[model samples]
Target chain A: MHRTNSLLTELKKNKMLFLMLIPAVLYFIIFSYLPMGGIIVAFKYFEFDKGIFGSPWVGFKNFAFFFQSGQAWLLTKNTILYNLAFIAAGMAVQVGVAILFSELKGRHIKKMMQSSLLLPYFISWVVVGSFVFGIFNYEFGSLNTLLKGWGMSPVDVYGNPSIWFFIIVGFYLWKLVGYGSIVYLAAIMGINPELYESADLDGANIFQKIRHITLPLLKTTIIIMILLQVGGILRGNFDMFYQLVGNNSLLFNQTDVIDTFVFRALNQQGLDLGMPAAVGLYQSAVGFIIIVSLNALIKKINPDYALF
Target chain B: MAKNKIRRIDMLIFTIIGYIVLGCISILCLIPFLLTVSGSFTDDSSLFEYGYRLIPQEFSLEAYKLIFQAPEVIAKAYGVTIVLVFTGTLLGLFFISMTSYVLHRKDFKYRNKFSFFFFFTTLFSGGLVPWYLVMIGLGMKNNYLALLLPHLFSVFHIIIMRTFFTSIPESIGESAKLDGAGDFTIFARLYLPMSIPALSTIGLFIALTYWNDWYPAMLFITNPDMMPLQYHLYKVFNSMQAAQIVAQKTGIPVAQMPAETFKMAMTVIVTGPVILVYPFIQKYFVKGMTVGAVKG
Candidate 1:
């Protein structure tokens, strides 16, 4: 009774704060929590007329269909492999750019370079898709045009499955390297100038200072960023894949990820909600396990870094 | 003296290599945009003949003319996008800041609980199907609210805002409370004014998200009139029929149309504003990203 009375008094005292939180709380409940309840659709054979709860359960048949189709392994492999490639390549390029940016001598030139580098990050994927088409379209693409002009046979980039791995990773890095570098740049900026000065006093060169001091300090930030990325390793970037390789069946073997698979399954003529939802649940369950385990690990090592 | 000379040479070599690498990357970043611009201006026949180039072999304004002639579709898209961007950014910023303010309150008893409430959503989600069903169930199909609502309150933005709020000294809010200012009043009259940088940073992020958004529109909007700019451009890119339809409506010969150049032209037109305004607002993005990373 006393605990309930104190809780009521606390609520009364901070009523305005609670009031301010209502919209956000309601947003999450409607958008996030409610959908969580709808995850059961994975096990159901859904009909539009029947609605989510009214749909008849199918008992893992959706997962059976997915695995039977062989897309389950393909998409899972593609998603994880692509993400691992992106994470590794992105770190190297971004950290390199940040370090080089620090070494840059001229302010105006640095600003201009930074602006140009960041230009791609601002535009929509649709625009990037057009750029890809302009450059890689078999007949009219700039690359083919140049090849034909040079007395060489034109390359059919889109028809080829093997090259798209490079194309997707290239565009991903192109769009993000500038944006990603900023975090590292900020970390570099945050480092004590005194450390660098002392290194200089010891007759250390720029490379030596970077190797001994800058890199060691940057290790934590890099690890945290990588850990954060690893937590979402199952979640493919739907926009990037969809925009770049839209329904290109030839490239599907190399390019298809969990996101695009789910998207196609959901949007295809006859909605098989069960299979797609099953795939989605698979992604979510694995993703959730990864994140929870990672958080637990981080909390054990340093609570400050734990996402929870 | 010999060691000093070697050190100077090493520094020079490093600087030279840095310039070359950074310069090459910058050029790689810029050349595609240059090709798009050049292709937009290139005559139809020449574009087909020569492909996209750094400079147009034969300059023509036909693509731009065709678009502007029956400008209603493009203009409507722009209008839809502008409204979504402005309204979404304002409302999202207000709600995000308000929530952040409450969460940042040292005196608030449930701040940690509330913080966890927002943060927990990031860890796991019900995935796309359920979320799509919820959106459909809410009658968001073909509705502008679909675009506005889903994006209005990102947990990432909330975290960034809360971190910004925490940076302000607690004594200010405490003294304001002592002066008989209520929480809302203090948030509105004091904290809001003080957090312009945070507000603008988050506002710009929200605005950019809305402006570049096509996924929501692609999912929810089947109505042609309701399509936002990016989705409209997407449609133009995917279907030659869209360009042909526009050309036919304008009484231009479909055979004479620059469908290839038209796509590039549309890309330029859609992306022009962002490129133009990027230089001015990019620093805030950098600041927001850096701050978010530091404590996120």
Candidate 2:
């Protein structure tokens, strides 16, 4: 009774704030929470005539189909491996560029280089796909035309699946290195200048300064960034995969992730809703566990970096 | 001294390597764009003969002319994109900022609870199938709302905006309250204006997301007339119809048309505004990234 009275008083006191929050509350409820409730579709035999709630419950059948199909392992392996590659390559390039940027002397050159590097980030992946096509297309592609000019046989990139892992990672870094570097650059900037000054007084070389001071200070930021990325390691960048590889089944073995698989199963495979939903639920549940456990780990290590 | 000489050499080597590395990466980043532009302007026969080059072998405006010949298609796409970007950015910025404002209030008892409420969505979701069903259930198919709604409220943006608001002195709000100001008026008259840097950063991020959105359009919009610029470009790349229409409108035989060059031109046209304005707005993006990194 006392708690109810206090809650009423608090509600009365902050009526406008509560009112202002209603739209966000409603938005989240509709977009996020509603779908969360809809995860039950994974366990059901969904019919078009009957809604998600009305669908007949078929326990574990959808999951059985997914696991039995052998796609579950492939998708999981591809997603984790590709994300690991992206994170490793991306961190190296981004950190390297950030260090170079901080060391470089000319302001104009730095600005120009940074701007040019960032250009690819602004363009859509579809444009990147077009660029890839322009370079790799068999007849009119630059690669084939150059090969033909050199009196060598033209190689078919799209026909080859093994090369796509490198291509995907290369493009991911190409688009994101500049953007990612800015974070480390900010961290580098935030480091105490007096440390550098004292090092200078000690006659420390630029490389030593970077090795001893800059890198050490950036450790926290890097750790936090890696942890953040690790949390979403299961989620594939659907835009990049879909645009670059598209409906080309030839490359699906090399490039397919959980997202594209779910997408194909939903749109292309013709109404096998339960299986896709089951895979999605699996992805979400694993991703949720990863994030929660990682957050706890981060909290134990450094409370400030913990997402929660 | 020998040590001084070694130090100078080390600095020299580092400087040279820095320039070389940064220069090469910049050129690699820029070469594709240059090739696209040059390819778009190259004559069809030359493109077929020599492929894309940094400089056009035979300069021609025919591809662009073909695009302008059917102006309505590109114009309508630009229209849809513009409307979506403007409406989505404004609404998204307002709601995001408002929510952040409430959460940033030091006195708000439920701030942590609300923050968690938004943040939990990022950790898990019902995945695309249910989200798609939810949109379909809401009758968002073929609706522009489908495009606008999904990119509207990002949890990341909310966190960034709240962090920005936290930088503001709380005494300002406290003083405003003493002067008979309601929370809404204080937020509107003071907080919104004070938070322009954060606002612009988030606004540009939201605007860019809306501008570059094609996934939502692909899922929801089936009508050709409803396509945004990026999706339209995707269609042009995939389908021959966009080129065929150009060929028909210009009275050129489809066999003789510059379909490849036309695709490149369409890409350039679609991507042109972003490249043009990127230099001016990128600092804000960098600022946003840094700000998020600091507190995130």
Candidate 3:
């Protein structure tokens, strides 16, 4: 009764503040929280006329169908493996570039490199997709032209599936590595220069200082970055995959991921009922589990790095 | 003496490798853009016959002609994109800052509770179907509201905005309150102006998101007249349906258009303005990203 009295007083005191929160609160309620209940559609036979809740309930049939589709394992494997590659390679390149950025002495040269590197990050995926098309298109691709000019056989970048593993990863790095490096660069800039000076006093070389000091100091940032990435292992970059390898079912074996697969299954197939919703729920469930587990693990190791 | 010499040698090697490797990567990044621009200028026949050359073997304005041939459609898309960016950015920055201000209010005892309430959405979301249904149920289908509302406020933006608000001394708000400003007045008159750096950064980020957005347009919008630039480009590049749609609307022949240079020209048209506008807002974006990275 006493606690309730105090809570009422507090609520009355901050009435304006609470009023300010209504927009955000209502947004979350309508867009986020309400839709959360819609996850139940994943277990239902959704009809346009019947609606989400009005649809008849079905259980795990969508999941079973996805698994039986024979592409389930491939999608799962591709999503996880591709993310792993991105995490590892993205970190190394980002950290390496960050350190390189810090080492460069000429301000003009540094600015130019940084600007050029960041150019790709600002452009839309639609633009990047077109650029990639230019490089990989069969009749007028840059690579094929070069190959032909050099008296070698031209490669079919489109029809081939195997080459896309590199293409997807390369394009991702090309597009995002600059954005990623800013994090490491910020962390690098924040590091005290005195630490490097002391290392130099100890007669440590550039490589040793980087190995012993820079990388060690960056350990937490790197782990946090990787741990952050771990949550999205199940979700694919639909924009990148869609724009780059798009509709080339021939490359599906190499490039098809959960997002693209579900997108096609939903939009293209009109795959009966709520199968796309079911897959989305599956991705979310898996993502939630991984994030929670990772947070708990990180908190145990170092409380500072816990996302929560 | 030997150790000193070895250290000198190492630094020299590192510098050499750094310059070489970084130079190579820079070249690799720049060349494709150059190729595309040159390819855009090449005549239709030469593009397919000779392939994409850094310099056009037979230069032509055929591609430019095709795009300029349909000015009305392109103008409408541009108008839609600009309006989307303007409204979305302003509303997003206002509502987000307003919401974040409350969360960061020094006297607000329920701040943590509300923070989690907002933060929870980022960590967990109901999957796509219900979200789509909620949108459709709300009658967002084919509506401009669908594009504006879904991305208007993000949990991540709220977090960043909240952090920026916290950095402002409580005394600022307190003094404003003493000066007879209401909570809303203090936020609008005092806090918003004082928070220019944060405002610009967040505003630019939101604007860029709107500018680059096609996902919402893809999902919700089907009207060709209402199509934004990015989605329009995606359509043109991805399918013949887009050309057929254009032909249907404009009654122009797409058959005679040069496929190679025409598509490349479209890429330039859609992307060139943003690239030009980017430098002005580059610093703000970098500031926002740094804040998000370090704090988020």
> Which 10 residues in a row give candidate 1 chain B its minimum summed lDDT?
B239-248
Give the per-residue Cα lDDT of candidate 2 at A275.
Answer: 83
Error of 2 at B206 (Å): 0.7
Tell me the fnat of candidate 1: 0.78
Best by DockQ: 1
Query: Which has the higher DockQ value, candidate number 1 or candidate number 3?
Result: 1
Query: Which candidate comes out best when scored by lDDT?
Result: 2
lDDT minimum window of 10 residues, candidate 3 chain B: B245-254
The residue-by-residue lDDT of candidate 1 on A1-308, one tens digit each, is 99899779989999988899999999999999898888899999998889997889999999899999999999999999999999999999999999999977889999999998988999989899999999999877889988988999989999999999999999999999899999999889989999998876777887897899989999988988898899999999999999999988889999999999999888985687988999999999999999999888878866888887
Please give, for residues B1-296, the per-residue lDDT of candidate 3 as tens digits: 98789888998898888878777777777777788888888899877778888898899888787777677778888999999999999999999999989988868988999899988887788877678779988998789998899789988888888888888899988987888878888888888998888888888888888999898888889888888999999988877977776566556677766876878888888888887887777777777888888564
lDDT by residue (A70-170, candidate 2, tens digit) is 99999999999999999999999999999999988899989999999988999999999999888888877877877888999888999999999999999
Q: Write the per-residue lDDT of candidate 2 for residues B1-296, one digit (tens) a residue.
A: 77678779889999999999999999999988988998899898887778877788899998898888779889999999999999999999999999999999878888888999999898889999999899999999899899999988999999888888888999999999999999999999999999998899889989999899899998989898899999999999998776676666678888877788989999999999999999899888887877777664
Worst lDDT run of 10 residues, candidate 2 chain A, spans A266-275
Instruction: Please give the CA lDDT of all the candidate structures.
Output: 0.90, 0.91, 0.85
Q: Which of the two candidates, 1 or 2, achieves a greater lDDT against the reference?
A: 2
TM-score for candidate 2:
0.97
After superposition, candidate 1 runs with Cα above 4 Å error: A1-4
TM-score of each: 0.97, 0.97, 0.96
Which residue pairs come into collision in candidate 1?
A: none
Candidate 3 recovers what fraction of true contacts?
0.76
